[model samples]
Target: MLSALKRVLIGRPLKSTELGEQKLNKTKALAILSSDALSSVAYGPEQILLVLMTVGMAAFWYSIPIGIGVLLLLTALILSYRQIIYAYPQGGGAYVVSKENLGKYPGLIAGASLLVDYILTVAVSVSAGTDAITSAFPSLHAYTVPIAVVFVILLTLLNLRGVTESASVLAYPVYLFVLALFVLIGKGLYDMATGAIPQELHTPVGTPVAGIGLFLLLKAFASGSSALTGVEAISNAIPNFRKPAPVNASRTLAAMGILLAVLFSGIVLMAYEYGIAPIAEATVVSQIAEDAFGRNFMYYAIQGTTALILILAANTGYSAFPMLAVNLAKDKFIPRMFTARGDRLGYSNGIIMLGICSILLIVLFGGHTEQLIPLYAVGVFIPFTLSQSGMMRKWLREKPAGWGIKLAINTVGAAISFVVTMMFFLTKFPQVWPVLVFLPVLIWVLLGINRHYGAVGEQLGLSTGEPVEVIEGNVLILPVAGITHVVEQSLSYARSLAASQIIAVYVPFEREEEAAFRDKWSKLHPDVRLVTLHSPYRSIIQPLMKFIDVVDRKAKENHYQVTVIIPQFIPKKGWHNFLHNQTSFYIRTRLLYQKDVIVTTVPYHLKK
Candidate 1:
């Protein structure tokens, strides 16, 4: 039934050979990979307005400068990641690139930062999406957290179904959002050019702008840089692309950069041109929309698309985290489970983990995008710095064609990203220190996992082909309930080992049952001796354990090893196992720590 549900929900499990069939083309890849970058445009402007509003109306004018600064960083990221795609064509994100060039600690730092960033991407995106809804209908404000969580679950489920399915489900909505925004931008531009401003524009008269300082401008710039969050996702997941993965990934990256620059700049300009103040529950985007088209159907359409693309943006993390986890697992930094693909040939475990983490953040932060914004850029910029530095190191060492220009570009990018990293580090220290705290802990964890795998490999004698064995006096003890065909089979199999001794012991609940079992057992097994154990407490495992302990004590004197064989009856159906006492499992679990005493089970399948 579970398998059927999985098949129904995520489609049939694909074979390893069918992997290539699941690769995504450019258009779908852009939608799946670029959602986070594009969706941030929805809340990126608002975050800036949020911080700048605290400084008063005068600081509002700084939005353009801060926005232009972020766009410059965006341009650098686009160029840097394009180089990354070509250099590490097999989808080497910051983790792989930095680890390969910048040493292990730097690589691990990059990996941990990206991991946290992806989690926040889902949280912030879903929260911003919910804000769009709450903006539309104020009555739904209280349900914002729950709504964000539900969106995470839905996005998680969609991603688990594989890339193609999710792209198909989400691509149209992204296109619709892009089209609507461009329409709004064009209409807004036409209004500006023709000098036809709306007369009934309703601007909420906010409290007068407060005192201003350089710190406030930095705060606003840090807040606005969220538009750069999803920029690296495309570079991180090149393996998910179609043939010519690097070429196609680079094209998509370029397209994403152009689209984000146009939309983000346009939205911020529109907000500033119309003098859309940071109002109550409504967002700056919503305010701009209403002023541009009023509270009509077109306004609702843009709001609807905005909500969808924002929620779907969580898919960016869903795709990247799993692949990154798989990479970490391969390096023995995390558990091996993430290395396995799901039914739909996607990294199901990683996707689910990302979703849960994102949901918890939403609940903890009360689904507020502004609250998560400060912590957002810290996770993002660390990786951006490391990735660009990794590329710089690569170019200097490789000296390929155009390496000089590439190195120069990556150098500037690395410098800018490092500055941004310190900006958030100083500005949002209280909130972002946890990320720094997690970095060394993540490195320690990776080291521990690598140590564990090494120890297991050594213990297994994997270095050599053969294991040295010394024969000892071995005794086989069959733990049976009563004389039956299953017991006979276990006894017969135990005899094949040619041990020093073979003993069959029966633990009975009552005296008569013990006597009857002995009488029946003596007639059938004349060659083997039958020992009956009587328990006063009527506990099955305790008496059996005592018997094994005695046997082990006796064997110790004789320089022998004791092996306990339990006969198991296999139920025809999975549910039928619940009907039995389950003593077979109990005995094995109890004997796991018995040194020199081996416990084994021989199963007899039941027909009905």
Candidate 2:
């Protein structure tokens, strides 16, 4: 069932070589990595205003302090993670940082945190983008979930085409967004300085609170800190950059940090100057656009830019989630399938998996950013704290040249980040604690289960120290339906196996047909053996299954192995697979359970 759903949602997996020949240069890789961080410029202001809204417009000034705090944290995180790229250029990001210094449990914590953060990145970005677009066209409001799902599907397809393709497609729009936003914010500032500014735009209504409290402060900080969610993605993509990966990666991180800080600050200052209120439904970009341009062409342009950036922000996850999953799979924390690359040389399975989960989240949350925000920051902050702590630990353990200086800065950064993270849980846990509790427990349980299974298989001395064994046998038995390409391929395969004996078994439904089949076999291969089994019940699977059991019993007595080669046809497009492969599938399943038996499949292609 999961396979069917995967096929319906993600499409067929492609080989790594099929991803195309293009490699990402540092500029393009940076753009791709920065998409998530740059995207925060659109909604980061809105998130702050969201928290402050409860306190009324009089408290909106708090956004400035919150933004500054977040910016400081962002700068520290960028610097700290830049060291991460330098230390581990192979690109494990937070996972590598925690694992190498803080040990396996911390590594797992980081992995789980990053995983959840990536998932929320997709959900929040898509929902926020959808909200922006819907604001431009009110008719789209009711179809937000559908639109988000379609967007995710399109992004998944683009990612499957290759990372370079996705980056190329998104770069132009993201750049346009940066240009448009910069222009808009610049225009707003110029008008404010020149006294040409329009009257204050009425902000969204909110419940008035008496005063600022610790809870409100923590909530504001948590909302502001979400801007840092994708800062680590650049570190993860260090390996994907051109030669001199560390130098290129660090340079890219620097550029991203400068641009993001500027953009984030500009948006917040502009929103504050315009007297824009905290909007529960609209984004800061849209609110600013509406006020600055008053629903004119420039307004639409800013709206378009913000919407595009939000959608492209998910590209950050597209770029990072697969790499993290591949890393986890390498460590045996995730299934090996996630480690496999697709035709685009990207983590195709991981991409599709994330896309599906994100779409489900969009649907479940009704594409509302506010509803999903609670589950958002905890994952990101957990990793941020742990990763910084891990780097501090590494600095202490190694005591390398200049270690003292780096350690002092990292220690301070880690301490501050850890306190903020704890505060986030305390303030947001009423809403987010459930996810924090659920995701970690779930990940640990899965890890424990995998370890238990692996340990048991190791004790049993199984192949590759894993529970599953690759079946091997010699005797070839092909279940055929007269002569076809499927039969031809099965015969060719059996010949290749070079078994001591080959048997073609068929279950005859009628007496005359059975006699004619025997006569034809007698003429075709008189020297070779042909077994005819009668199914008076006219059942295909049962007779073949019984015949295979009998063959297995006989082969064991004679000290021979049984290799069942089923001649199965590929189902035509739009045809039910169960009707075509049920017999062979049952026969193979039943035979595999028996001792000294191997199952092989020789697939025959069907014409379109």
Q: Write down the TM-score of every candidate.
A: 0.89, 0.82
In candidate 2 the C-alpha lDDT for residue 539 amounts to 88
Clashing pairs in 1: 56-209, 56-210
Q: Specify the poorest-scoring 10-residue window by lDDT in model 1.
A: 199-208
- Per-residue lDDT tens digits for candidate 2, residues 1-608, read 77776556545665556434445777787778898889987776777887888877877777787888888888788889888899999998988899889998888888888887888899988888888899889877889889998988888888886777778888888888888988888888888889776545423334244788877876788778777778899888776777787999899899889989999998888887788876555667887878777889999988887888888889899889988888888887777899877655777799989999898888888888877766776777777888888989998889899998788767766876787778777777676777757776868875885697688767877455555534344567888879666787778778777788899987898899899999987887675578888888988888777787888887777667788887777766645675554776777787777666788878876875
Model 1 C-alpha RMSD vs. true structure (Å) is: 3.6
Model 1 Cα shift for residue 417 (angstroms): 1.5
Instruction: Tell me the lDDT of model 2 at 390.
Output: 91
Query: lDDT of all predictions, in order shown?
Result: 0.86, 0.80
By lDDT, the best candidate is 1
lDDT of 1 by residue, 1-608 (tens): 88888778778888888889889999999998998999888888877888877755555667787889889989998999998898888775999999999998899888888888889989988888898989999999999988998899989888888888899889999999999999999988988788776533323333244576677777777778878898999888999998899999999999999999999999987876687787768988888899899999999999999998888888898889988898888988889999988888998999999999998889899997877877887898888999999999998898999899999999989998888788788877887788768777877888899899878777888566666545478888898887678888999999899989998888888899998888888788888877888976888888888888999998878778899998999988999998888989988988998776888899999999
Model 1, position 313, has a per-residue lDDT of: 86
lDDT of 2 at 526: 78
Q: How many residue pairs clash in each candidate?
A: 2, 3
Q: How much lDDT does candidate 1 score? A: 0.86
Q: Candidate 1's error at 223, in angstroms? A: 1.3
